[model samples]
Target: MLAKRALSIAGGLAVLGWPFAVWLALTYPELHILLPILALCFVLRLCALRGKTGALSRAFKGLALAGAVLCIASIWMREAQLLLWYPVVVNAVMLTLFGSSLFSRMTIVERLARWREGELPPEGVRYTRKVTQIWCFFFLFNGSVSLFTCLAGNIHWWTLWNGMVSYLLMGLLFACEWLVRQRVRRRYE
Candidate 1:
């Protein structure tokens, strides 16, 4: 449990680091390298996998790696425009997904879903439902916003790709959450 908790924190940091690193690497150019980041990610994933179920930690680790690559790419390509505001996106994800963990009880679905392993249980059905809905809105907004930024031609490749991935992943999770809720409600009623 402690291990998983730490993994979540580290994962959280990495998530926050995404845009900052992307901007720094892009703007600072000659200073960044891909190998160390990849290696660190691999190590974190390995550590995270130990204390938690295979499914949960692995997904985050994957997200970290994918995110790191996108960041590195953005840096290589010199796209650092959104480095400052990227934390808003990170905060949104953290609050919606992780913040829910702090208040919620062990959600039956989350327990089964494997995404909530190291995190606290959801508070209740209402909390879970609301969080899911909020995430849906986030995805829809970010997905569209990132693409628009991409078109404006100032955004880094990293930001665009990361935004797309975030949007897609959140939308998928939201749909899955909605379906589970529907099934549960139908079954119970």
Candidate 2:
């Protein structure tokens, strides 16, 4: 159990630090060295998810599998350029997961909100659905920018956008959402 937890942490870090890893790869060994490490991380992540069964778990497993496959292909083909697509792929997977949740009984945001507050009233449900839609739009916009960076073939631009700017944008969005949620909750109360 401890080992699994450790692996899960490692996997999470690998994902969160992906842009830094890519920057290091670009700076040092031309990304050849990083591909194998990324593949290992993805594999470990998948292993950590073993015995978990749910739509969310399945989505995460699929993401790790996709990452592993991308790294493996980059290694096999000896094409470091292929590594640039990982961010785009990540966003695409996220968009799919969040967008699909809209049609389900609960939006992804609603599911998360439920975890914090037992059950949601009608207003909460509507709010979460709107929040989920906002997130879907963010993912779409972010992914488009990521794809643009990849196609531009400029490492500095790619690193800056993917590594720094995107994270800042996401954080800002999250902060804004939290503030809005507070107001919504107060009004509903």
**lDDT measured at residue 116 in model 1 versus the true structure, 0 to 100:** 35
RMSD (Å) of each candidate, 1 decimal: 10.2, 1.4
Q: Worst ten-residue run, lDDT, model 1? A: 82-91
Query: How do the residues 1-189 of candidate 2 rate in per-residue lDDT, one tens digit apiece?
Result: 899999899789778888778777766775568779888999999999988987779888988888888889877887667778889988898899899999999888899889889889999999999999999999999999999999999988999999899999999999999999999989999
- Clashing pairs in model 2? none
TM-scores of all candidate predictions against the true structure: 0.45, 0.94
> How accurate locally, in lDDT, is each candidate?
0.52, 0.88
| Model 1 misplacement above 4 A | 1-11, 42-46, 54-58, 68-127, 155-189
| Cα-lDDT of candidate 2 | 0.88
Q: Per-residue alpha-carbon lDDT of model 1 for 25-116, expressed as tens digits?
A: 55566646632463365356546655454333545554555555555544565554434334344434444454355355543235544453
Cα RMSD for candidate 2? 1.4
